[model samples]
Target: MSMFSGTIQTLEQSLNYASAKNRAISSNLANLDTPNYKAKDVTFKNYLAKELSQPLQAKRTNSKHLSFQGEAQPAGYKTIRQHATSYQHNGNNVDVDKEMANLAKNQIYYQALVDRINGKFGSLQTVLKGGR
Candidate 1:
Protein backbone atom coordinates (compact mmCIF):
# COMPACT_ATOMS: atom_id res chain seq x y z
CA MET A 1 0.00 0.00 0.00
CA SER A 2 0.99 3.60 -0.57
CA MET A 3 2.23 5.79 2.27
CA PHE A 4 -0.92 7.91 2.34
CA SER A 5 -3.45 5.12 2.09
CA GLY A 6 -6.31 5.07 4.53
CA THR A 7 -8.34 6.80 7.19
CA ILE A 8 -5.34 6.68 9.53
CA GLN A 9 -3.35 9.04 7.33
CA THR A 10 -6.25 11.48 7.15
CA LEU A 11 -6.75 11.31 10.88
CA GLU A 12 -3.07 11.96 11.52
CA GLN A 13 -3.13 14.94 9.24
CA SER A 14 -6.21 16.26 10.98
CA LEU A 15 -4.57 15.91 14.38
CA ASN A 16 -1.58 17.85 13.23
CA TYR A 17 -3.78 20.52 11.70
CA ALA A 18 -5.83 20.85 14.85
CA SER A 19 -2.72 21.07 16.99
CA ALA A 20 -1.38 23.86 14.82
CA LYS A 21 -4.70 25.67 14.97
CA ASN A 22 -4.70 25.34 18.72
CA ARG A 23 -1.28 26.94 18.86
CA ALA A 24 -2.37 29.81 16.65
CA ILE A 25 -5.46 30.42 18.74
CA SER A 26 -3.43 30.29 21.93
CA SER A 27 -0.98 32.76 20.49
CA ASN A 28 -3.78 35.16 19.62
CA LEU A 29 -5.10 34.88 23.13
CA ALA A 30 -1.63 35.37 24.56
CA ASN A 31 -1.05 38.60 22.68
CA LEU A 32 -4.45 40.03 23.42
CA ASP A 33 -2.88 42.64 25.68
CA THR A 34 -0.08 43.60 23.32
CA PRO A 35 -0.48 46.75 21.25
CA ASN A 36 -1.36 46.37 17.56
CA TYR A 37 -1.36 42.59 17.72
CA LYS A 38 -3.32 40.96 14.92
CA ALA A 39 -5.18 37.71 15.38
CA LYS A 40 -4.12 34.69 13.35
CA ASP A 41 -5.54 31.26 12.51
CA VAL A 42 -4.83 28.03 10.64
CA THR A 43 -7.83 26.64 8.82
CA PHE A 44 -7.60 22.94 7.87
CA LYS A 45 -10.12 22.79 5.02
CA ASN A 46 -8.22 25.02 2.63
CA TYR A 47 -4.87 23.45 3.37
CA LEU A 48 -6.28 19.92 3.22
CA ALA A 49 -7.97 20.66 -0.10
CA LYS A 50 -4.75 21.95 -1.56
CA GLU A 51 -2.86 18.86 -0.35
CA LEU A 52 -5.55 16.44 -1.62
CA SER A 53 -5.51 18.11 -5.01
CA GLN A 54 -1.91 17.10 -5.54
CA PRO A 55 -1.45 13.92 -7.53
CA LEU A 56 0.39 11.16 -5.70
CA GLN A 57 2.68 9.17 -7.94
CA ALA A 58 3.02 5.43 -7.82
CA LYS A 59 6.29 3.60 -7.30
CA ARG A 60 7.86 2.23 -10.48
CA THR A 61 8.37 -1.52 -10.41
CA ASN A 62 10.49 -1.54 -13.57
CA SER A 63 13.61 0.43 -14.42
CA LYS A 64 12.19 1.44 -17.82
CA HIS A 65 9.05 2.91 -16.28
CA LEU A 66 8.55 6.65 -16.59
CA SER A 67 9.34 8.66 -13.49
CA PHE A 68 6.62 10.81 -11.90
CA GLN A 69 7.29 14.07 -10.12
CA GLY A 70 5.19 15.17 -7.19
CA GLU A 71 5.36 17.87 -4.57
CA ALA A 72 6.58 16.99 -1.10
CA GLN A 73 4.03 16.73 1.67
CA PRO A 74 3.55 19.72 3.95
CA ALA A 75 5.75 19.61 7.03
CA GLY A 76 3.80 22.02 9.18
CA TYR A 77 0.76 24.25 9.29
CA LYS A 78 0.69 27.73 7.75
CA THR A 79 -0.79 30.34 10.01
CA ILE A 80 -2.50 33.32 8.38
CA ARG A 81 -3.42 36.62 9.89
CA GLN A 82 -7.08 37.25 10.64
CA HIS A 83 -8.08 40.44 8.85
CA ALA A 84 -11.51 40.99 10.27
CA THR A 85 -12.72 44.14 11.96
CA SER A 86 -11.15 44.98 15.29
CA TYR A 87 -13.22 45.84 18.31
CA GLN A 88 -10.42 47.21 20.46
CA HIS A 89 -9.31 50.81 20.34
CA ASN A 90 -5.64 49.77 20.47
CA GLY A 91 -5.94 48.11 17.02
CA ASN A 92 -5.72 44.60 18.45
CA ASN A 93 -8.10 42.13 16.87
CA VAL A 94 -7.99 39.18 19.23
CA ASP A 95 -11.42 38.42 20.58
CA VAL A 96 -11.13 36.58 23.90
CA ASP A 97 -14.61 35.08 23.79
CA LYS A 98 -14.22 33.80 20.26
CA GLU A 99 -10.78 32.43 20.97
CA MET A 100 -12.08 30.53 23.99
CA ALA A 101 -14.89 29.05 21.92
CA ASN A 102 -12.47 28.00 19.19
CA LEU A 103 -10.14 26.45 21.74
CA ALA A 104 -12.90 24.30 23.17
CA LYS A 105 -14.14 23.27 19.73
CA ASN A 106 -10.64 22.44 18.56
CA GLN A 107 -9.99 20.34 21.65
CA ILE A 108 -13.10 18.31 20.93
CA TYR A 109 -12.07 17.82 17.33
CA TYR A 110 -8.56 16.78 18.27
CA GLN A 111 -9.83 14.27 20.82
CA ALA A 112 -12.26 12.78 18.30
CA LEU A 113 -9.50 12.36 15.74
CA VAL A 114 -7.27 10.66 18.29
CA ASP A 115 -10.06 8.31 19.29
CA ARG A 116 -10.79 7.38 15.70
CA ILE A 117 -7.14 6.63 15.06
CA ASN A 118 -7.01 4.46 18.16
CA GLY A 119 -10.07 2.57 16.93
CA LYS A 120 -8.40 1.96 13.59
CA PHE A 121 -5.38 0.53 15.32
CA GLY A 122 -7.58 -1.61 17.53
CA SER A 123 -9.29 -3.03 14.44
CA LEU A 124 -5.91 -3.80 12.92
CA GLN A 125 -4.85 -5.53 16.13
CA THR A 126 -8.02 -7.66 16.03
CA VAL A 127 -7.26 -8.69 12.48
CA LEU A 128 -3.70 -9.59 13.40
CA LYS A 129 -4.91 -11.67 16.34
CA GLY A 130 -7.23 -13.69 14.07
CA GLY A 131 -10.33 -12.27 15.73
CA ARG A 132 -9.42 -13.79 19.08
Candidate 2:
Protein backbone atom coordinates (compact mmCIF):
# COMPACT_ATOMS: atom_id res chain seq x y z
CA MET A 1 0.00 0.00 0.00
CA SER A 2 1.12 3.53 -0.69
CA MET A 3 1.83 6.06 2.01
CA PHE A 4 -1.03 8.22 0.74
CA SER A 5 -3.38 5.26 0.84
CA GLY A 6 -4.44 6.51 4.23
CA THR A 7 -7.74 8.37 4.24
CA ILE A 8 -6.40 11.02 6.58
CA GLN A 9 -3.53 11.85 4.25
CA THR A 10 -5.88 12.20 1.31
CA LEU A 11 -8.08 14.54 3.31
CA GLU A 12 -5.04 16.57 4.32
CA GLN A 13 -3.95 16.95 0.71
CA SER A 14 -7.47 17.94 -0.28
CA LEU A 15 -7.46 20.62 2.40
CA ASN A 16 -4.25 22.04 0.98
CA TYR A 17 -5.66 22.08 -2.54
CA ALA A 18 -8.85 23.73 -1.39
CA SER A 19 -6.90 26.36 0.51
CA ALA A 20 -4.85 27.17 -2.57
CA LYS A 21 -7.97 27.39 -4.70
CA ASN A 22 -9.59 29.67 -2.12
CA ARG A 23 -6.63 32.01 -2.31
CA ALA A 24 -6.80 32.12 -6.10
CA ILE A 25 -10.53 32.78 -6.13
CA SER A 26 -10.20 35.47 -3.43
CA SER A 27 -7.45 37.18 -5.42
CA ASN A 28 -9.59 37.23 -8.54
CA LEU A 29 -12.48 38.78 -6.62
CA ALA A 30 -10.16 41.34 -5.06
CA ASN A 31 -8.80 42.39 -8.45
CA LEU A 32 -12.15 42.54 -10.15
CA ASP A 33 -11.72 46.27 -10.75
CA THR A 34 -8.02 46.32 -11.55
CA PRO A 35 -7.29 46.92 -15.23
CA ASN A 36 -5.90 44.08 -17.31
CA TYR A 37 -5.97 41.73 -14.33
CA LYS A 38 -7.03 38.39 -15.67
CA ALA A 39 -8.70 35.94 -13.31
CA LYS A 40 -6.62 32.94 -12.25
CA ASP A 41 -7.55 29.43 -11.08
CA VAL A 42 -5.81 26.40 -9.62
CA THR A 43 -6.77 23.05 -11.04
CA PHE A 44 -5.97 19.73 -9.29
CA LYS A 45 -7.36 17.29 -11.83
CA ASN A 46 -3.92 16.75 -13.36
CA TYR A 47 -2.39 16.15 -9.97
CA LEU A 48 -5.10 13.66 -9.05
CA ALA A 49 -4.62 11.81 -12.31
CA LYS A 50 -0.87 11.62 -11.85
CA GLU A 51 -1.23 10.35 -8.30
CA LEU A 52 -3.74 7.71 -9.29
CA SER A 53 -1.71 6.55 -12.27
CA GLN A 54 1.49 5.94 -10.32
CA PRO A 55 1.12 3.48 -7.47
CA LEU A 56 3.81 3.07 -4.85
CA GLN A 57 6.42 0.40 -5.68
CA ALA A 58 9.18 0.00 -3.15
CA LYS A 59 11.73 -2.81 -2.84
CA ARG A 60 13.58 -2.96 0.44
CA THR A 61 15.97 -5.84 -0.17
CA ASN A 62 19.28 -4.02 -0.24
CA SER A 63 20.49 -1.02 1.74
CA LYS A 64 20.28 1.24 -1.29
CA HIS A 65 16.64 0.29 -1.94
CA LEU A 66 15.79 0.77 1.73
CA SER A 67 16.35 4.50 1.39
CA PHE A 68 13.60 4.77 -1.25
CA GLN A 69 10.14 5.45 0.18
CA GLY A 70 7.42 5.21 -2.46
CA GLU A 71 7.11 7.60 -5.38
CA ALA A 72 7.48 11.34 -5.02
CA GLN A 73 4.42 13.46 -4.44
CA PRO A 74 2.66 15.13 -7.38
CA ALA A 75 3.93 18.51 -8.47
CA GLY A 76 2.45 21.75 -7.21
CA TYR A 77 -0.58 23.37 -8.78
CA LYS A 78 -0.21 25.94 -11.55
CA THR A 79 -2.31 29.10 -11.39
CA ILE A 80 -3.46 29.70 -14.96
CA ARG A 81 -5.11 32.90 -16.12
CA GLN A 82 -8.60 32.98 -17.60
CA HIS A 83 -8.10 34.32 -21.08
CA ALA A 84 -11.04 32.66 -22.74
CA THR A 85 -13.67 35.09 -21.48
CA SER A 86 -13.71 38.82 -20.77
CA TYR A 87 -16.86 39.96 -19.01
CA GLN A 88 -15.73 43.50 -18.27
CA HIS A 89 -14.89 46.36 -20.62
CA ASN A 90 -11.32 46.31 -19.40
CA GLY A 91 -8.92 43.43 -20.12
CA ASN A 92 -9.93 41.80 -16.85
CA ASN A 93 -11.81 38.54 -17.34
CA VAL A 94 -13.04 38.19 -13.79
CA ASP A 95 -16.80 37.86 -13.60
CA VAL A 96 -18.02 38.77 -10.15
CA ASP A 97 -20.98 36.39 -10.32
CA LYS A 98 -18.89 33.42 -11.41
CA GLU A 99 -16.18 34.17 -8.86
CA MET A 100 -18.73 34.41 -6.07
CA ALA A 101 -20.29 31.12 -7.06
CA ASN A 102 -16.90 29.45 -7.15
CA LEU A 103 -16.09 30.90 -3.74
CA ALA A 104 -19.22 29.34 -2.27
CA LYS A 105 -18.53 25.97 -3.85
CA ASN A 106 -14.95 25.94 -2.62
CA GLN A 107 -16.07 26.82 0.87
CA ILE A 108 -18.49 23.91 0.94
CA TYR A 109 -15.83 21.52 -0.26
CA TYR A 110 -13.32 22.83 2.27
CA GLN A 111 -15.80 22.33 5.10
CA ALA A 112 -16.50 18.78 3.99
CA LEU A 113 -12.82 17.94 3.93
CA VAL A 114 -12.33 19.41 7.38
CA ASP A 115 -15.25 17.41 8.71
CA ARG A 116 -13.90 14.20 7.25
CA ILE A 117 -10.49 14.83 8.82
CA ASN A 118 -12.09 15.47 12.15
CA GLY A 119 -14.09 12.30 11.88
CA LYS A 120 -10.95 10.30 11.21
CA PHE A 121 -9.22 11.75 14.24
CA GLY A 122 -12.27 11.10 16.35
CA SER A 123 -12.26 7.47 15.32
CA LEU A 124 -8.59 7.16 16.12
CA GLN A 125 -9.17 8.66 19.52
CA THR A 126 -11.96 6.21 20.24
CA VAL A 127 -9.74 3.30 19.23
CA LEU A 128 -6.92 4.56 21.44
CA LYS A 129 -9.28 4.75 24.40
CA GLY A 130 -10.15 1.05 24.04
CA GLY A 131 -13.70 1.72 22.99
CA ARG A 132 -14.48 3.67 26.15
TM-score of each: 0.72, 0.75
Would you list the clashing residue pairs of candidate 2? Answer: none
Tens-place lDDT digits, model 2, residues 2-111: 53257777787788889999999999999999998989999878877887676565657677764433575654566788888777788889989988999999999999
Candidate 2 ranges beyond 4 A from true positions:
1-5, 50-76
Best by TM-score: 2
Q: List the global CA lDDT of all models.
A: 0.83, 0.83
Instruction: Give candidate 1's error at residue 47 in angstroms.
Output: 4.3
Q: What is the lDDT of residue 62 in candidate 2?
A: 77
User: lDDT, candidate 2, residue 81?
Assistant: 85
Q: Residue 14: error of model 1 in Å?
A: 0.7
